[model samples]
Target: MSVAKLVDRENQENGGKDWIVEEFLAFSDDNRFDCSDVLFPQPYFELSNAFVSQDNKVSLKHLHKFLKKWYKDLAGVPWHDTHKADGGYYRYWSFEAACSVILLEINDDKELYDYLYYPKDLIAFYHSFNPTAGEENLLNKYNRIAIKAGEKAPQSGYWFTVASNNSRQYFNAGEILPEIKKQDWGEVYWQFEKEE
Candidate 1:
């Protein structure tokens, strides 16, 4: 259910470019999730689009404006539930801001340094290592194990289908993999790449 909402959110936000979201939409029987209650500010999308533009100055201006507005309305946002007794686990976290900082490589932004929701430690942890290299290493270390779409996964780990773009996903042991509807590669087969 959560995966469905995530797919809807990403699809609305960025045309569903994320691989994980695409994978969920492809395999899940129930792919629809109600997001009518969700509150997505327009500025968030605008700020995201600004990053894709060639103008850094415009992007920075958008970032600054967004940060100011976001901080000003922090307590009013839907995810801001920290004041409630049972809200600790559901407390607001500025994931979007953290991602923006990382994507933009904005190391010297003083405003972000003081922002309460900015995940400095998380961003630092992300910057500490190259995760793509780690994934490549994992792929190289494991033997490529191929299985048909209807076959159950022999081991629980990450797998990729050569038939579709952004088809890499995780599967549990005994879970049946899915085939692409379009069959772009002439029958989908999943190839094992790594273990959880």
Candidate 2:
């Protein structure tokens, strides 16, 4: 579902046709089960469509409505049967709904504050940190570099890490790239920043 959403977003950013979302809708139509005794509920099948729909505003509205009734909708699901031996300790959270909320940038929904399935903390953390923003900024600034940690330097040049303030250091060809350890930024990897 996340991959489909990313593809949809990429297509939208590049002004391309929404073929990925269309393919997903088509796949769902092709895999329809005739019987009513299916393991996955009908709502489960509709999740991807609601998440990665071409019309994001409408899809987000539908997603908000669906999340309101998510817990009640899963009343008779056979999810517990498969995990009975493990004491059914798994959390029954609507991860997809939370992900949709984050991806759609829907922040004004006050009703979702109380939804049990809604991962409020996760959403808060994602909004607060916005890890992708830094990466996107770096990509825009240094589009030529694509090297990562542990990779041998393709050629002798000055390299820098994306998520770190470390100065660009010169590296010899065939030298292994080094990583910077930082708590806030996670693993900072080297990228080709400039020529010698």
Best by lDDT: 1
Against the true structure, candidate 1 reaches a TM-score of 0.45
Q: How big is the positional error of residue 30 in model 2, measured in Å on the Cα after superposition?
A: 22
Candidate 1 Cα misplacement greater than 4 A, ranges: 1-41, 71-78, 130-196
Residue 44 deviation, candidate 2, in Å?
Answer: 3.7
- Estimated TM-score for each candidate: 0.45, 0.38
> Could you report the Cα RMSD, in angstroms, for every candidate shown?
11.5, 11.4
- Candidate 2: lDDT of 116? 69
Top TM-score hit: 1
Q: In model 2, how many backbone clashes occur?
A: 0
